[model samples]
Every structure is written in structure tokens, then in C-alpha cells.
Target: MSRKIERLINLTIALLATKRYLTKSEIFRSVEGYEGSAETKERMFERDKDDLRSLGIEIEVGSFDPLFNDEAGYRIKQEKYQLDLGAITSTEVSLLSLAAQAWQGASFDEAAQKALLKLNSMGVPSDSLSLPTAAHKIDDGGGDLPLITKAIAEQQLITFTYVDSQLDRHQRKVVPVGLSSRSGFWYLSGVDQDVQEIRTFRIDRIEGEITSTKGPKDFEPPQGFDPARVFDGSSSQSFAIIDVRKGKGTSLRALATSAQSLGEWDQLKLPIYNLNTLASLVLWHGIDVYVQEPLELRGLIVAQLETLVSNHG
Candidate 1:
């Protein structure tokens, strides 16, 4: 791991040091880790480029020569790569230091350390900054995240079995555009091959291994593809009437359009976007919440709870 990190750092330095864009041939000849056969070097360089991009290093690719048509070259522009949020106040510096310190023991600790080192080099004092220990942790989405990210970066097609809100499983081929996290769940937004439309799938709902169907840079993401706009907000906003125990269902309360106190129970008229997601939320409160008006939603929750019980049993 240390050797890989060192190789990436060396590659970045070499790329940034070069004034002109360096081609694959030049990189293989000049970089430290490019040993063995031509095929081996090519594979190593490809993986290195992906790794560097994952680390937030922007590698620009273009032709070095205008007079002659040559293979495209790659270079990390020093200006684009450097963090230059010019002349921040002391309060902002202190806040940044705290933010950096919050990554301690997390997946981003090393990257945070390297960033702080760069900031310190720029005359910002971060070495002695103290901060409260992070009380929360972010899950890195297991093995699938890296593969999905690689596909996104390389503009490659991917295949995965995704379970929808209705619990129907379907095998899908997609060109992933972006990934986003909301309410602790990760979603992959992409162009679905069969439907020929933009679709978003919950990462956790992906049934099995995510497979790459094509090589890097095979296709380009559609121009101005906004993943957030893929879902139809109007279609998802269906109302549900439910009763919750007093002092419970705090999260659900935020979704309630109207709430009325009925002795020990609080009746809520809520707009449910995804029934499966809402069912999960309701189930989290155990027997404290009850769906009254919608028989279908109540049935869904009961079925889900039964499946959970059977699985646990």
C-alpha cells in the first residue's frame, strides 16, 4: 500500500513538473513504477491514472504538438491542481483546521494529512490545531463503490441487478454519470440502456457484483445530465395517513403534512415518495406507528416485517 501511494505521489510530481503534456510512451519511460513489458506498463499507467483521479488530482489530456498529429498526452496542471482559496481569515483557517482534524481515524485520514501538509507549506498553521474527536463515521460502500467510480471516471458501461422500490429485480446496463448520497443512502444516476432514459438506483438495492461491460473512455456522459432531476417529484408525492405513538416517529414527523393529537397517538397525513423507503422508516419504530388510511402501504409494511421475522428466525 505504501509503495502504491509512493508511486502515485511520484507520478503526480512528474506530471506536475512537466510543462508539456506527457504521452503514455513518455510516462512509461520516465515514471518510477513503469517497469516490465509494454503491456504491463500500459496496465500500470491506466490504474495509476484512475487512482490519481480518485484522489482528486485533475489530469488534463490533449495533443502536445499542433504541427504533427500525435497520440494525446496527459499532464496535471499546477494551477488547477493546487488549492488556492486566496487569503482566508483566521476564523476560517481555524474552521478549516477543525474540518481537517475531523477526518482522524476515518477513510480520508491520509488524504486529509497530505492536504494539511500542503496547506501548512502555504504558511497556514495546522500542525498544532486541536479538534474534538469525530463521533460519526461514513461507510465507504464496500467493494462496489470503487468499481462504480472507476466506470464513472472512465465513461464505461456497467451491468448490475437492481431491485426497485416495488422490490422487482431487473438486470440493467447503464452508462453511469454521477453518484450522490442523501439521508445516508448512496444513489447511482446513469443512462439506462434498455429504457434509453436517465435513471437513479439506490446503491444498497444493487443485488450482487457490479460488472464493467466496456473499457475506459468508451462513451461520454450526456451533456448537462443532472442526476437530481432524473426522478419525477410530482409522481412520487402520494399522501398516506398514519398514527404514531407520542414522543416517537421524530424522523417521520418531518414528512407529515398535518398532525393531530388523538390521546396516546398522533395522527399524521404524510406525503410518501417511495413506499419501500417509508415502510422501512415505519418499521424502525417497531409497533409504535400504524398506517390507517392506506391499506396497500399497511400490507407492504406487514409483509416486510414478516420477511424480516422469517429471516431472523
Candidate 2:
């Protein structure tokens, strides 16, 4: 971890550990990371406060005496800082863990880990029960979600390198209107300014950091635009058949539109958005999942496995 992050975590832990607000002088002396001149420490504290607040962690700022309005103190309130989800079940824990995993290598990894630690303190023991649901998670574009979501909320245009299905890389400028997750993969629904079309970019396919386009971005989506329906209204629907081992691939079982029990295994029929996506989910299951149909989907998985073996060998 970097010094800034370590200092921020230390600062947060201190504030949260205290029941009452701590004054700046007390924090400088108590917090382990503060150093250098008093003025330097003061600047660091201000930036740290803003950084924590940017990540949705609220820092309570107030005075001990309302009438006197004395020197202000800072602290994080448990009620405001912690997740509001109460009485979470084991299944929920697994799902939450999977969500947390998406941030493992992302910029928000530390903050995500903080939330997971909070879960442990909540007396909810996480488990491997969401094996099937866990398959829905892909680590691709999730890391850049903090920036993308921020841009969407602020209605800004972003530029990034995108790797297409053909293994070609191209720079893309998109005014993200909204974002949607389907089949465990996230897709950014936006107005592609370069192509001048309503386009959807799979988050996993993005090649690098998504930076904002220069100048002011007051872009808007088409009137009455709906992101969730970006993949809707296709002329034909496609489906995939996966034979999953019994008591495994729970997420697949839940998403299956139809299923047939086969003694030791379950044959599942699921609507598929694309062969690549279906292959990605199937790969997550490893030997536990087998594509029963759609030669294309099965071929994709087989090819990926072949490449994996070749590279390691």
C-alpha cells in the first residue's frame, strides 16, 4: 500500500474507533501517519478528509459546544459510514464477496476490502455457497467502474482504448449515458461520438484507463433513452445448453431458463447474449460445466482451453 492510502486508513480507523469527535491537534498526535511541519500536516488532513468523502465515507464535522462554537472536530459515524444492509444471510455474504472480488485489482480495491472487513465485524461469516453466482462475476472492466460511474453520474465524455473481438485495439470516445450489467458482464451504454451512434461497449473489452475527453462534456443521450434495453428488440433470441455437475454452478442453475436433472448432473438451458459471454461463464465453472450445444459456443471454450494449455506447457 502507498503512504497516502496507509495514512488514510490509519486516519479512518482512528476516527471510527473514537466515540466522540477528535480535534485536529488530537488527531495529529494520535494518528501514526502525520509528520513534517504543522502546516504540512494540516494540508494532508484536509486532502485525506476529501478523499474519504469522495468514496462515500462521510466524515462528521462539528464542535463540542453548539453555543460557544469552539474548534471543530472530525470523526466518522458508524451509522453513516457502514453499510445499511442488516441481517445478511450466508447466501448474501457469498454474493457480497463476489462483488468485493470484482474490486480486488481495481482502483477501489482498498475501499472494497474495507467494506468486506466491515461485513466480518457484522457477525456474518462468508461462505463458498455462491459458487454459481460467483461464476457471473468477470474481472475485466469492473476495476474502472469507479471512474465510469462517476462520469455517468456527472454526464461526462470518456476516452479509452478498446479491444474488439477481432483482437484489434482502437481508441474510443464515448459519452456514457448509462451502464447495465447482463449475464454477469458489465456493458457501458453510451453515445459513441466517433461513430456517432448509440453503442454498447463491454467493460471487459476495454484495454486501459478510461480518461475523460478534453473540454466540457454536456452530452446527452437520445431522448427517452433506456440503457437496460440496449440489447433488447433483437429479431431472434439465442440460447445455450450447459451440463453442470450436481450441487455445483449454482449461479448457472438460478439463471437457467429451463433445466433437466440427469442423476449426477443438471442439463441447463439459458438465454445467451453471445457465444463469447457464454464461453466465459462456462470457463468459470471449469470441468464442472460442459456446453451441450451450439457448436460455436463449445468450440470457443475448447479453443480457449487449448491456448491456456499451450501457453503453460
Candidate 3:
């Protein structure tokens, strides 16, 4: 990390750790990388404020007194600064188990661990990813993971109630084919008997119990069916070059194959293990992270953001 990035992380940690707004004098005395003459420190502080805002981190500026004009103080509101992905759906242990089967020790292992550390520092529990490989074993509120895994292993037909992205609830019958995992979510891709087509279902979104409709080896997976490519047609892996705003997209920075300083934005060549997974990660950084290559990935990011705005409009 550069001195500036270290300063920014330290600054963020300090501001987020405090309950009260810290004044400029207090910040200079306490926060690292704020050295130099008073005038120099003032300039650095102003630039830091701009950089933080560019990362979509809101710094609250207020005064100590309402009646008398006092020196302004700064603090960040957790509700505003933190990405409220909303308790984020938990990772399914079964998905991790499935991933462990096909994980194959890829480029994301190191970056994944670093991202876990960053998340843990932000007060997110470390249990989800206590260790690199152990990270894949944690539960994601998918209590039916074991059942799903068992159904797959037995080659049995299973029935379960699932809620789709649109919140439509329906009972699904699937002839277990193969399993796929990405970004902590487990997906069961198989032949949906009712729809008479292959569909991928997120394990966590599955509601109620998964019942085995028949004995083991009840059905065979469709000929030449590829679970990873089912429904969404997601590639196994992709490489992307991203334009990350300075002092932002810290997670991406950690995962980049190469990062070059581009003044305002850092150009990062990153290996994308899963495009949807990478898309979600990039979206988390908001405008601070921009995809400069792989137009498909950029389109996905924009489409997801637009859907969020449209649905929540």
C-alpha cells in the first residue's frame, strides 16, 4: 500500500471507530500522514476529503456550538459510509462444499483471503471465512445444503420450494445433474421437470425442506449438460482491466494481476474467477470502481445498478 492509501485506510478506521466528530487539530495530531507545516497539512486534509468523497464515503462536517461559530469537526456516519448490502444473505456451507469439489485452487485464493480480512475489519464476522479453504466451508443459512448435496450424490429427483429473483414462489422438481458455486452462494443446476428446461437455483433462496422424490439413481443428468454453463452461461473464468478511482476499490486493488497508477484512477488488470461474483464486488465500490475492459462485464454492472434504481425507485 502507498503512504496515501495507508493514510486513507487509517483515516477511515479512525473516523469510523470514533463516536464523536474529530476536529482538524485533533485529526492532525492523531491521524497518520498528516504531517508537515500547518498550511501543508491543510492542503493534504482538503485533498483527503475530496478523495474520500470520490470513494462515496460521506464525511459529516459540523460545528461544536450552534450559537458561537466554532471550528468544524468531521465524522463518518456508519449508515452512510458502509455498504448496507443488508445482512447480505449468508453463505451456504453446502455451496462451499460443492465449491471445494471444483474449486481447483485458482487465482482468487489469495485475493479472497485478503478480501475476507478487509471485511472482518469492517466488523463483519470472520467466521464466514476464518481461513482460505475454511472460508468455503462456512454456512450461508442454507440449511438444506446437506440435503441438496445428498440428492445430487444419490442422483435422485428432488422437490423444493424456491423464490426467484422476482419473488415468485413455486415448487420445483429437479433431476440432479451437477452443482456450481460462486461468491459464497451455491447454485443447483439441473433439469426443472415442471418447466422442462434446465435452470439454476441459488441454494439460499430455496425455502422449506428439499424432499427426495425417489430413490437413488432415479434419473440421469441430460447428455452433454454443463452445470457451470446452465441457465446463465457464465464462463469458468475471465480477465478484466478495471479503472479504479484512487484510494478506492481496495478489494479490487488486492486482487489485481497488475495495477498501474493513472493519476485520478488506477488501472488494474484483474482475473475474474466468476463474472457475476466480480460484478457484485465492483458494484459494491459504486462509482469508485470502473470496468475499462470486457464490455460484457461493464454491461452487467450497469444493468444491475439500473435494475436496483428502477426497482427501488
Candidate 4:
């Protein structure tokens, strides 16, 4: 672990072990890793508190010296810091083990592993049962996901240039409310400042870096605004009819209106949110898929394949 992470761990352990809140000066003097001038130590402690809070550790700040007006002290309440799940069956433990294993090689693998280790240290027995390797894996949503997630968590206003399904580009100012994934795509749902409406933007379609328009906690998500209900993935008017091979096109099936089996293929009528996206999914199946209706979509797929062939040739 790096120095910062080690410091955070030490800081957490120190806070958790203390019976009463520890003052900032006490922490700076007693904490093993805190070594700097008074100002530097104060700044580092402030950032460390934020980082620990971001990781779901609840650090309570209160005055330890009630007799006099003493500076505020900080401590992580054991009740808030520890998991309180009453009981776990063997089946649940096995499921948790499998869930932990599923994060292997993904961006969150380290954090998942650490969580499992912590749980195991709490006396949960490990199951010997093995599960089949996962066929589908989570995408990291490029690098913007963390930024968007932070924006949502902090309720910050953000600005980004986004390209819509019709390939129209616009600079959007939004107060990010939530982040969700659908069919391997990550979306950021927010209140669009220009339109003054709730809208969802696919993270991948964001043209450039997402920048914060204001400080954290700048806006509030509307009451009972669930991103699941807001993001329907049907933003375009056009739809496509295609034939997919059996056991394929699972993601496409979710957006399809109707499906009928035709021997080796499953005929599907899917809404065309973006022709480019539809064409790309069709090409992903290669020879196993074919467009049945709308000559325009077929032409788009053929043109894409021709371009690929020309580029390779």
C-alpha cells in the first residue's frame, strides 16, 4: 500500500480504538504517519477525514472538552463503522464468496478483496464450494465514471459536451443525481440546467472531460427520482428488425419489442436509439446476425463492414 492509504488505515484504526473523540492536535501528535508543520497537518487531516468518509467510514466530530471551548475532536463510532448484519446462512456466505470472486480483474477487485478479508476476519467461515467463472464482466466505464460518481455523491453541478442519438452535440450543465449501468453501459442521470428537466446521459457518449460547475452539495436530487424510471433507452423514433443467433443478443433482447424464433435465428424488433450503436451491436455478432427490415439500417451495417474491409485491406 502507498503511504496515503497506509496513513488512512492507521488513522481509521486510531479513531476506532479511542473511547472518546481525539482532538486535532492530539491526532497530529499521536498518529504515526502525521508528520508536518501545523498548517500542513491540518490540511492533511481535513483531506484524510474526507477520504475516510468517502469510503463509508463515519467519523464523528464533536468537542471533547466540554468545560472549556476546546477545538473539535474526531472519532469513528464503532456502531456506525461496523457491519450489523445479525446472521448469515452457509448459503449466504457461499453467495457472498462468489460475489467477491466475481470482482476479480475488475477495477474494484482490490476494494472487494479487502472487504472480503475484513468480513472473514470478523469470523465468517469460508466455503469450499467453487462457482463457474463469470462469462460477463463489468466495464470500468472508461475513466469518467469515478468523476461522475463523485459528482453524484457530492451533489455537484457538472458540465460536459454530449452527443445525442441523432449525432447532435450540446454542452450540458447538470446537477448529477445518480449513476447506473444498463446493458454494459454506464449512465449519469441529472437535472439538465438548460432544459430544466430530468435526463440521463450515457457516460461513454460524453465528448470530453466532465468538469464541476460548482462546489460540492450544490443541488439536491428530486424526491423519489429513480434513475431506473428516468432512463428508458428509447430516446430515438426509429426502430430496427433483425435476426439474432440463438443464445446471443441478450442485451438487445431487453430493448426489443417482440421476438419470434425462426429455426437457427431469433427474429427481434428493437428500437433504434442510435443507428451507429445499433449497427455496432449487429456487427459485434458478425455472421450470426442480420438486418431484416429498414434498408437504411442494413445499408449502415454494410457500409460499416465495407469501411472495415477497406481499412484492413
**Residue lDDT tens for model 2, 1-313:** 5998999999999999998889999999989889999999999999999999998899999878789978899989988887779678988987777788766565667777987887777777777673555344345445677788788877788998999877999998888878787876889988888777878888888886889744244655578778877765342287888899999999788768789999999999987776776788889989999998888898888899999999999
Between prediction 1 and prediction 3, the one with superior lDDT is 1
Better of 1 and 2 by TM-score: 1
lDDT scores in order:
0.81, 0.82, 0.76, 0.82
After TM-score superposition, what is the CA distance of residue 221 in candidate 2 from its true location, in Å?
6.9
- Please write out the lDDT profile of model 3 over residues 109-131, one tens digit for every residue: 44445544445455543234444
With a 3 Å backbone cut-off (N, CA, C), the pairs that clash in candidate 4 are: none
lDDT of candidate 1? 0.81
Better of 2 and 3 by lDDT: 2
Question: Arrange candidates by TM-score, highest first: which order?
Answer: 4, 1, 2, 3
Give the count of colliding residue pairs in each prediction. Answer: 0, 3, 4, 0
44: Cα error in model 1, Å: 17
User: Which parts of model 1 are misplaced by more than 4 Å?
Assistant: 1-83, 88-109, 127-133, 141-155, 163-170, 182-185, 196-200, 204-208, 213-235, 248-251, 276-290, 298-313
lDDT, residue 99, candidate 4 = 79
Highest TM-score against the true fold, candidate = 4
Per-residue alpha-carbon lDDT of candidate 4 for residues 1-313, written as tens digits (9 for 90 to 100): 4988888998999999999989988898888878878888889999999999888899998987789898999999998989776687666676776777776776677777897787777676766766665776667657676677777877778999999777899999998888788878888888998887888888889998889856434455689877776546445577788998999878778778889999989999987766777788889878888898789998998889899999999
